[model samples]
Target: MAVQDLLRQRFFPHMWCPGCGHGTVLNSLLRAVLELGLSKNEIVMTSGIGCSARISGYVDFHSLHTLHGRALAFATGVKLSKPELTLLVPMGDGDALAIGGNHFIHAARRNIDITAIVMNNRIYGMTGGQFSPLSGIGVKATTAPYSTIDNNFDVVELATAAGATFVARSTTYHARECTELIKKAILHKGFSVVEILSQCPTHFGRKNREGDAGQMLENYKKITAKRGSKALEENPGLIGRGIFVEKEKPEYCQEYEKTIALAMKGAGR
Candidate 1:
């Protein structure tokens, strides 16, 4: 199907800012869904409260624009009820890592069959310019005018250590990479996460003096090193981008079905 078939154009004038990179991420996701040959009925999209979370309202699929930091919980329920459906949850830095952190880790640990995409724009773009959990140390925000002292959480690392079977990273600058990685994540059996380094030109750009959205994307190209690259080996501080983890695991829904069968047999019914 054409990619335009997946959109709800009535929401055309989106809520995101003029230069926000979430648009690229959304485009990649829609393209990936199309490439996967998933019909709108077969795909379930969920999101929480954030600029990125606004995607749920735009996608012409079974969507749930849920509460703050609760998209995973809602998505999990949906998956348990209809294990055959493809579940996708897209969230922002604060929505996924701050209030939704507990759910994020627990879902990873459960290894449920859901693809969660994180838009890491550093600062909170939706609710004014505050430093998000993914914001770098010393980054300036409305809350941290001088500089932020909070250490940023590494989303890829967190997912890997939480038992996610699939994890990948891409930047808004790398549109092809984002689509390819998300395509892989969707096909994975267990829980999968793809973190996209999105740019917030209004908030992050102005705060860090990173010029315009174009400049921020250029910086992404300059800073991102491929996994196991010689450049990363030499610098040791560069953000490595690639599929960091992919492993076979029993999906949560399938295991739960097995448990139900076992209980029924034990009851002699």
Candidate 2:
């Protein structure tokens, strides 16, 4: 399928700021979908309120633009009702982990057949650059003019510990790697989480002096190493990119079917 066929062309001239990495993420995601040969009707994309959430509006899939921090919740219901459809929930860092933190963890715990994409730009981009939960200590933002004293959540660790059967991390700088990871995450049978460290050059970049979009992309290249690589072993601070977890597990919807069968037997139906 042509990538253009998967997009809602009427919504082009996307709203994301120039140099924002979210657009790159959108491109990678679409490419992954195309490579997987998924029809528009077979996929569902849900998103919450944020710059990243706007993605649902551009894709020609069954889309749901739900309340802030609730994309996963709505997606859970959709997957439960229609288990055959592929569920894709793309969310901002703050949208997924700040207000939506509870839902994020529980969704992983349930191991439902949903792919949760976290666009981790590390700031609340649409809300005037507030410091988000993923915004690490010493980062400046509108709400943290003196720099944030709070720590950031390690998304890969959080997702893995929360019981997501498939977990991975990548950055916009590594576009091909990001696309491959998304493809793997979507194909995984149980709950999957892929954290893509996107760049918000307008907000996060200016506030933290992270340089322009290109420079930030370069920084990502310098800071991240492929998982299990010798560079990562030598320099522990480098964020590792690649699938962190991929294992078979009891998927929620299939287990739910079993529960229903047991209930029917009990009722002599």
TM values, all candidates: 0.98, 0.98
Tens digits of per-residue lDDT for model 2 on 1-269? 67888889999989999999999999999999999988889999999999999999999999999999999999999999999999999999999999999999999999999999999999999989999999999999999999999999999999999999999999999999999999999999999999999999999999899999999999999999999999999999999999999999999999999999888885853
- Provide the RMSD of all predictions against the true structure, rounded to 1 decimal: 1.0, 0.9
Worst 10 residues of 2 by lDDT: 260-269
Task: Please provide, for model 1 over 29-65, each residue's C-alpha lDDT reduced to its tens digit, 9 standing for 90 to 100.
Answer: 9999998888899999999998999999999999999
Best by TM-score: 2
**lDDT for each candidate structure:** 0.94, 0.96
Evaluated at residue 40, the lDDT of candidate 1 is: 91
